[model samples]
Target chain A: MELYDLELSGNCYKVRLLAALAGIDLTLKPVDFLAGDHKRSPVIDLNPWGELPVLVDGGTVLRDSQAILVYLASAYAGHAWWPDAPAAQGDVMQWLSVASNEIHYGPNSARLVDKFGYDLDKATTLQISERILGLIDQHLQSNEWLAMGRPTIAECAVYPYIAVAGEGGIDLTPYQNINQWMARIKALPGYISMPGVA
Target chain B: MELYDLELSGNCYKVRLLAALAGIDLTLKPVDFLAGDHKRSPVIDLNPWGELPVLVDGGTVLRDSQAILVYLASAYAGHAWWPDAPAAQGDVMQWLSVASNEIHYGPNSARLVDKFGYDLDKATTLQISERILGLIDQHLQSNEWLAMGRPTIAECAVYPYIAVAGEGGIDLTPYQNINQWMARIKALPGYISMPGVA
Candidate 1:
């Protein structure tokens, strides 16, 4: 399997994190995101959205990190990371939506602005970050993991952006439960680190 | 099964559309969105996010329309709506993320601003809408359905917003393929309509 990735992107790191945890071997095809390489050939050819973390496994090509997680976990990993049950898939999916929507707009966008100098509303990103972080913190207060009562791809989908929220100039100090959850994820065997994620 | 719904919400309509198409029975528990009922006890108790289209199925409670569609299709609707294979699930999931992220921030947010008078960046919403709409149109140009080579929950997840894009002040006239795709979805068995869609 070939993964067209960006070293600093939380989205890309999330996929890599899942692969490492699930023991799935992948050849990392690092894209030169800083040089507008993602918008050009090979990458753009695979994904018209011109996004990083495009996975090409045999004949299957997928974009979007959440979708890639679904593919990788289901195909290569096993049911533990991506379950077969409908309700369980739905349970894991809620956080996948969170990762795709809230985390993307909140901490991810904030990092894009602060780290990559992308033109985005910093205040709005911070506001969104605070709201979503609060919700996740509260959710974590009662649950040991994000979903399925055990480690699943939900952790893989959500943990990267949060681990690197400091790069976005967003503070994670107040989110105690979230902090503990991050520690739990870090302590997991086969967990790997990327540029921004510790 | 119960759905905490709002008649005018595309998110809610997506779930209803899936139920109708899949023959899944749901007791409509319409929330008075205008009166801020969604933020109150019952709705908020089920989904702390205070979002519309919350589903409660006995032991299972799911929020996010995309997640609900996953549950309904996988549990009751069968493999035709939501497939069993990994690559197929990933294929369907690509658009699910679109429904959750791009569609939510794009046309959905635009509608929120224009129709519901929410204080959101209309310009940004339109920009996001244009980009995503163009991408979907382009994808539809080559493919018949969004995924799995036939109608699936992707249509339910995507159609409602595009059907009512006019309410968001988004002109869909340029996207001929999207219009055609919408027509096909409407022609599906057990198709239902919401306000501003027709």
Candidate 2:
């Protein structure tokens, strides 16, 4: 199995982090966004969207970070991280959807823009991030993880961008419960810090 | 179970569509955004974000339409609509995430702006809807359903919005495959249309 990875991507980080936690060995094949590798024809042939952290196993290819997380959890483990329970599964999916839509759109994009200079509305993005973070913080007030009382795919997808969001000029000190949850996720066994872009 | 619903909301429509298809009995509790219901203290006390279609089953309340889909499928049908196969699960999630993030953000929001008279950048919203419809056409080319090889949660969550997107002034003439897929899903047993807003 091969993972087409980007060191700075939170979604890609999701695949790498889960792989580390679940003990799945995959050759990390770096796709150079600096060289516009994902935008090139060859990579576009694999995924038309030209997105990063694509996973290729045997003859199959998968794109999108949340999709890759599901693939990793389902293919590698015995449904522990993904969970098979319906109500629990719903809770898990809710968190993943929030990560994909709100957090990624707001905080993740804001962080990227602050560091990398992507064109996005700054004030609105910050406001969006604040609302989402507040929701997460409220959820974490009693729950140990993001969803279903277990550290499921939701945490895997949402944690990275959120943990590093302060670097985007957004303050995290206000979100006490979320801060504690971030610490808890970081302290988990087999935890790997996201690769920093120098 | 009580569903905090808004008839005009595609997100709310998804929960209703799934509950009908799966035979899950739910009471639809209306929340009027125009009436400033969500901004008031009571609904926010349940969901601080004040989003619609919150599924309250016993003491557990689940938000997010995609989350609700997975929850209904899990609680009622186990892993049937969500699927359990790793590679298949990846397919299911990819479409599910797209429904929540892309379809909802693109076409759904565009429709809202045009039909609901919400202030927005009309040109950008139209462009986004076109891009999403194009992507949906591409996906429907080889697959019969939106996610996986079967009628998974992806189709259930997105079909309503995509089908009625024309109401929001998005021309559907270009998306032949999508039109065909929508027809096929409706032809399925237990399929139910959302209640008319009039």
Candidate 3:
């Protein structure tokens, strides 16, 4: 299997982190995102979205990091990461939606502005980050993990950008539960880190 | 199953459309959005995000519309809607992410701003709409359905907001392929329409 990756992107790290945690073999094909290599032939042809963390396995090619996590966990990592039961799958899926919608527009967008110099609404990103991060912190107050009472791909989908939220100039010190959850995630076996994630 | 719904919400309609197509029984507990019922008890207690389309099935309570569709499809509607294979699941999931990220921020946000008086960046929504809508139109130009060459929950997840883009002041006349795809979806068995969907 091959993964079109970026060393600095939290989206790309989601895939790499999952592959590591699940012991899946992947030949990483790092895209030169700085030079706009993602918009060029191979990456653009593989994924029209021109996004990082595109996974190709045999004939299957997936674009979104959430979808890639679903594929890798279900195909190779067994039921531990992606469950077969409908309700359990739904439980895990709510967080994946959060990963795509809230996390992407919030902490990820904030980081895009601060670390990557993207011209986005920094104030709006901070507002969104506060709302979502607070919600996640509150949820963590009652639950051990994001879903299924165990660490699933929900962790893989949501943890990367959060682990590096400070790079976006958002403070995580007030979120005690989230801090504990991050510690738990870092302690997981085969856990890996990217440039931004500590 | 009881769905805490708001009739005018595309998110709520996604769940209703899936139920109609899959023959799942759901007792609609309508949330009075204009009266801020979604922010009050029952709805807020069910989903802390205070979002519409919260599906409560026995002990399983799912907040997001995509998660609800996955639950209803995989549990009651069978593999035709939400597949069993890992690769097929990934194929369907990519569209779900689009529905959550692009569709929600694009057409949905535009509708929220125009029809419901939300204070948002309309220009950004339109730009996002143009990009994602064009991509979807191009994809549909060659393929019949969104994924697996069949009408799955991807249709249920994505078709609602696009069907009602006009309410958001979006001009869909230029996208011939999207127009054709909308017609095909409307022609499906047990297809139901919400307000402004036609």
Candidate 4:
């Protein structure tokens, strides 16, 4: 498998982290994002959305971090990372939606603004981050994992942005449950670390 | 199964439309979204995110439209709407991410701003809509469905927002392929229509 990766992107890191945790060997093909390579041919040909973390496995080419996580979990890790049952799948999927929507627009956008100088409202992004982080903290109060009783793709989908939220000027100090949840994810076997995360 | 729904919400409508097409009987529980019903007890208690289209099926209370679609498709619709294979699931899931992210922020947010008096940048939302719609049109040029050869949850996830993009000041007349794609979805057996769509 070949993973088109950008080291600084949380979305790309998600695929890397999941592959590492699952012990799946993936040849890293780094993209020159700053040089606008992703928006051009090859990358654009693979994913019209011009997004990073495009996975080319045999005959299948997939994009989107959440989708890649689903592909990896289903194809490699078995039910341990992603359940097969309908209810369990739905339960896990809700968090993937949250990751794609709230987490992406919240901490991810905020990070883009602060770390990369992207033109987005920092105040709004921070507010979004706070709102989603609060909800996640509340959700984690009773449950150890985001979905199901065990670690699922939900964790892999949501962990990166929340873990590196400080770079986006969003404080994690107030979210104790979220902090513990991040700790738990780090403790998972074969866990890999990204730049912003400790 | 009971679906907590708001008729005007594209997200909620996605579930209802899918259920109708799948021939699954769903008891609709209307939520007075304008009256802050979704943010109050019952709704808020079921989904802390306070989003609409919550599905209560026996032992499972599922939130998020994409997640609910997954539940319905996996539990009832067989492999027609959502396939069982890993690569196929990934292909379908990529569009679900697009619905949750691009469609939500693009056409959905623009609609919210126009019809519901949401405080958001209309220009940005329309720009997002244009970019995604263009990509969808390009993708649809060669393929009839968003993913695979048949209509999957990808179509269900993306259809509502694009169908009603005009309400958000996004002109859809330019995208012939998207128009044809929408027509194809409407032609599907047991397909249901929502307000603002022909």
Candidate 5:
């Protein structure tokens, strides 16, 4: 299997992180997102939306980070990351939605815009970040992971952007549980830090 | 099983529609979003994010429309709406994410701000709607369902918002394939219409 990826990108980093965790050896093919390479034909064939972190595994092309994580977990992992129980599954999935829909697109995107020196709606970004971080902090208080009682898909997908959310100008000091959770994630064996960060 | 939902809400409607199709009978409890009732105690217990379409199967309170759909399909269905094939499953999940993050949060939210007389960042909403609608239309032209050659989780979760996106102030008439897709989805037996429509 080959993963079309960009190293600096947190979204691309998600697939790479998951692959490493699940012991899925993937042929990594870097895509030049900055040069409008993802918008071209063959790349578009893999991702019609022409986005990064596209996974190609013989007769299959998959885009979107959360989707890729789900596939990898469902296909390869040994029953630890994805909790198959009914309510527990729902709980894990809810956080994944928050990661992809609320947090990542909110503070993560805002921070990216800041890092890249692009204009962002500052007020909205701050509001989104503050609220999302608050909800996460609240969740982390009673639970070891994003999902209660288990480190499921929720933690796998959401923890990274949250750990780096401070880079987007949102302070994480107030969220003690989140800080602790971040440390726990880093301690996992085979954990690789995202590219370009010391 | 009971579903806490609102009649006119696209997210809430998704839960109802899928349950009906999947042959699961849910006791419907209407949650009044207009009254700010969702933020209150028990409702908050249902979903900390305070969103609509919370499904309670006895003790299990499932939030996030897509998450609820996954639970329903995985738990109750005799057959698969969420295909087991990893690659196709990824594709199914990708569009479901698109429905929540982009389609509902973008165009659907934009249209609601219009109806509720809430302030909106118009330029951003327009940009988001155009991108989402164009992609959905193109996908529809080539694939009969958003699931891509199968009626998977993606279709059950996403079809409602896209079908009514024009009500969100998107001109769906321009996307001929989307128009056709709407007719097909509507033609499905047990199909239900969202509020403010015939």
Candidate 6:
């Protein structure tokens, strides 16, 4: 299997982290994102979205970090990472949606503005970050993991952005529950750390 | 089962449509979105995100339209709407992420700006809408369905926003392929239509 990756992208990092945790060997093909390599041929051919973190396994090519997480969990990590029950899967799927929507627009967008010079509304991104972080903290007040009471793809999906939120000017100090959750994720077996996370 | 829904929301509509097609009984509990019902107690208690299309089934309460779609398909739709195979499920999930991210921020955001007076960048939303719609059209040129070559959750996830893109000031006339895809979805057995789709 091969993964088209960008070192700085949390989305790409999540895929790498999950693959490592699952004991899956993935040949990391680094893309020149700054040079617009992802927007051109080969990468664009692999994923029409022209997004990084495209996973190619044999004949199957998958895009989107959340989707890739689902594929990895289902194919490699087994039920421990992603459950088989409908409701249990839904529990994880809810956070995946949050990862794609709230997390992407919130901390991810804020990071893009601060670290990558993307023209986006920082105030709105910060507001979204605060709201989602607060909600996750509250949810984590009683629960250990995001869903299924175990380390599912939900944790992997939402982990990177919240862990590296400080780079986006969204402080994580106020979110104590979230802080502990991040710690628990880091303590997981075979955990791999990204540049901004630790 | 009960669905907390707002009739006009494409997200909510997708859940209802899926249930209708799957022969699952859903008692629609209409939330007064204009009255800020979704932002308040019961709705917020059900889903911290406070978004509509919350599904309550016996002991399980699920939020996010995409997540609810997964739950419904897994529990009731018999793998027709959402397959169990890893690659196929991932294929469907890729579009679900698109539905949540690109579709939400693109045509959906544009609709919010035009139809509900949301303060958003109209130009960016239009650009995103055109890009995603064009990509979908190209992908559909060779394949009948978005994924798995059948009516999967991928179609259900993306159907609403593109079908109602005109409400967002995004004209769908140029994309003949997308128009045919929309028509194909409408022609599906047991398919249901929401407002502005026809």
Give the chain A TM-score for each candidate. 0.98, 0.95, 0.98, 0.98, 0.93, 0.98
Among the numbered candidates, top DockQ falls to 4
In terms of docking quality, model 2 is medium
Q: Which 10 residues in a row give candidate 5 chain B its minimum summed lDDT? A: B78-87
lDDT of 5 by residue, A81-164 (tens): 775555666677787788777776677787787777767687787788888888888977887777767666677688767766
Q: DockQ-based ranking, best first?
A: 4, 3, 1, 6, 2, 5
By DockQ, the better pick of 2 and 5 is 2
The residue-by-residue lDDT of candidate 1 on B77-113, one tens digit each, is 7799999899999999999999989999999999999
Local accuracy of candidate 4 as per-residue lDDT tens digits, A62-96: 98999999999999987888888999999999999
- Per-residue alpha-carbon lDDT of candidate 6 for residues B34-112, written as tens digits (9 for 90 to 100): 9999999898899878889899999999999999999999999788889998998899999999998989999999999
Please identify model 3 stretches exceeding 4 Å from their true place: none
User: What lDDT does candidate 1 reach at residue B29?
Assistant: 95
Q: After superposing candidate 5, which stretches have Cα over 4 Å from the reference?
A: A196-198
Q: What is the C-alpha RMSD of each candidate to the true structure, in Å?
A: 0.8, 2.4, 0.7, 0.8, 1.7, 1.2
Instruction: Tell me candidate 2's interface RMSD.
Output: 1.3
Off by over 4 Å in 4: none
Question: Regarding TM-score, does 5 or 6 come out ahead?
Answer: 6
Between the candidate structures 1 and 5, which one is better when assessed by lDDT?
Answer: 1
DockQ of model 1 vs. true complex: 0.89
Candidate 2's displacement at residue B118, Å, is 3.0
TM-score of 4: 0.99
Candidate 2 lDDT over residue span B74-186, tens digit each: 77765667676788878878878888777776777787788888775666667767887887899789978876677877788778788778767788888889888888888
Query: Model 6 chain B, poorest ten-residue lDDT window?
Result: B189-198
lDDT of 5 by residue, B1-198 (tens): 888888878888888887776677899888888898899867888778887888888877788988898788878874377665566667788987887678766777777777666676866777888988888888888788787676666776777766666666767779898777767777876777777432
As for candidate 4, its clashing pairs are none
lDDT of 1 at A51: 94
